[model samples]
Target: MEALSEVKLGPCRDSPYLRPLRIHYTQNGTRKHWDFMQTHDSVSILIFNTTRQSFVLVKQFRPAVYMCECARRGIMPTVDTASKDCSPQSLVAGELLPASAGVTYELCAGIVDKSDLSLQEIAKEEVLEECGYNVSVGNLQKITSYRPRWLQQEGTEAYRRGTNRHTPTVCAGEPSAADYWAAGGECRGHRRS
Candidate 1:
């Protein structure tokens, strides 16, 4: 069985778009490694109050997503994002290069845990807590799930460990991207009350 034991911080670096972290750990049979360098796992959902056509959108700032805003604006040139070697002069100025550094618009989300609940259940709970609406689990639809590909590059510490570990990606692109499904039993009664 593959079991992870103890983790120690090795190296850390950041850019406007990504935060790279290196954690050393022992796993599996012999001495192994576990990397959590640039990984993201999240959940998003949609809730409908059919009575109102307008939908609820959660506004939040994601450090990884927003770090690119400065670069996108051209205020922080591309070289600033690609350069890994920092000169002694640059360090004297007390400047740090990052992947992205701005406020980003994102759906309501939270990380999934290995508890009794499933990922679907976690999604429903987050939607209700963030948007204040009850959602049907069976009606949940999967959107897009992925790990960003911009983390790997020369001179960057984005990739963690030996590059074998995989991160879990769970989101339907955006929170509003998912369609709402109402379960049966009291369609007319729910609207009336």
Candidate 2:
């Protein structure tokens, strides 16, 4: 993975990945302007290594997720502290983070923009880019599509956190594929749609 120079986004709200959006519409017979996120739609490839009964997952530090974790745990980042490099080794070489600020296990995913490629093609690219396993578009099948709308950060009043909905009610240690299936979070086998 190519490591880019560490760039601090001013005070957090000025993130380059996010842009403020204005939506004007009528609600309850009144015209109002609401702020919304114009973020790109995303796709995920939930790869299950059936032979090994394990899922191919990626563990990385998502600064956004890390921010919410910090707020939930009342931990703050020191101004001068920044991760020089986000690699596994360099990630831990900075000021100590809260216990909640740990890596997250997620499927290979990417935004559905930047190209006219279909979702299947995008999924294959993510699998290769994030998991290092080249996948063919023919073999890549689409499954459930999700919005992940629950993931909210400190934003405008319209998008502020309503509750601790992002927090998982139960924290389980790394589980097997079976465990994941039982929890309604995993697909036992790959089934093309």
Candidate 3:
């Protein structure tokens, strides 16, 4: 968990989601570079809608996910033939998403800022704020605390774009940003292979 470098690109003009102020500066020897710039903070949740046996997932148009092949690799589930009615490709290709395939679903997650709040507390708050759910701190599972896909704004779409034939129906909260669309909408451009 070492920060290699950070670069701030500067403020955005008409971003309805974020306020522009600071840019990231990356460590490059004695000089920090601007190419590694990034957002100040972000958060996401892996909410399980217990009643539906479905995970609460978010969707948005991600330029970065489109830029990288992450959209393809991230949602690709490994095969387990012992189980019936599911395979990685089938899970990916199915009209409906399984609990596992929904893992890559992205939402508007923010970085913890206030000094008074602990990360766990912040995580609980974010889940409530983003999804309108009241979850206990004990119920929250602390997954890996790292930004493996800091750049993947919409990588979830990759496994999803051409396969919305049976995607789950999501009960979404008010979207934090334009990228945040409901989990499944009437298919617009999902093309099957």
Best by TM-score: 2
Q: How far is candidate 2 from the true structure (C-alpha RMSD, Å)?
A: 11.0
What would the per-residue lDDT of candidate 3 be over residues 1-193, giving only the tens digit for each residue? 1111121122234454334233356566554422222233444556655555555654433334332332355533354544555422432333222223323346524465655865556666665554555556665555545443423445565222322112111122222323223332213211101
What are the lDDT scores of the predictions, listed in order? 0.44, 0.51, 0.40
Candidate number achieving the greatest lDDT relative to the actual structure? 2
TM-score of each: 0.41, 0.57, 0.38
Candidate 2 per-residue lDDT over residues 101-135, each given as its tens digit: 54577766677675678777777666656655555
Which regions in candidate 1 have their CA more than 4 angstroms from the true location?
A: 1-40, 46-55, 61-103, 152-193
* Clash pairs for candidate 2: none
As for lDDT, the candidate ahead, 1 or 2, is: 2
What is the alpha-carbon lDDT of model 3 when measured against the actual structure?
A: 0.40
Q: Which regions of candidate 2 fall more than 4 Å away from where they truly are?
A: 1-16, 26-31, 77-100, 146-193
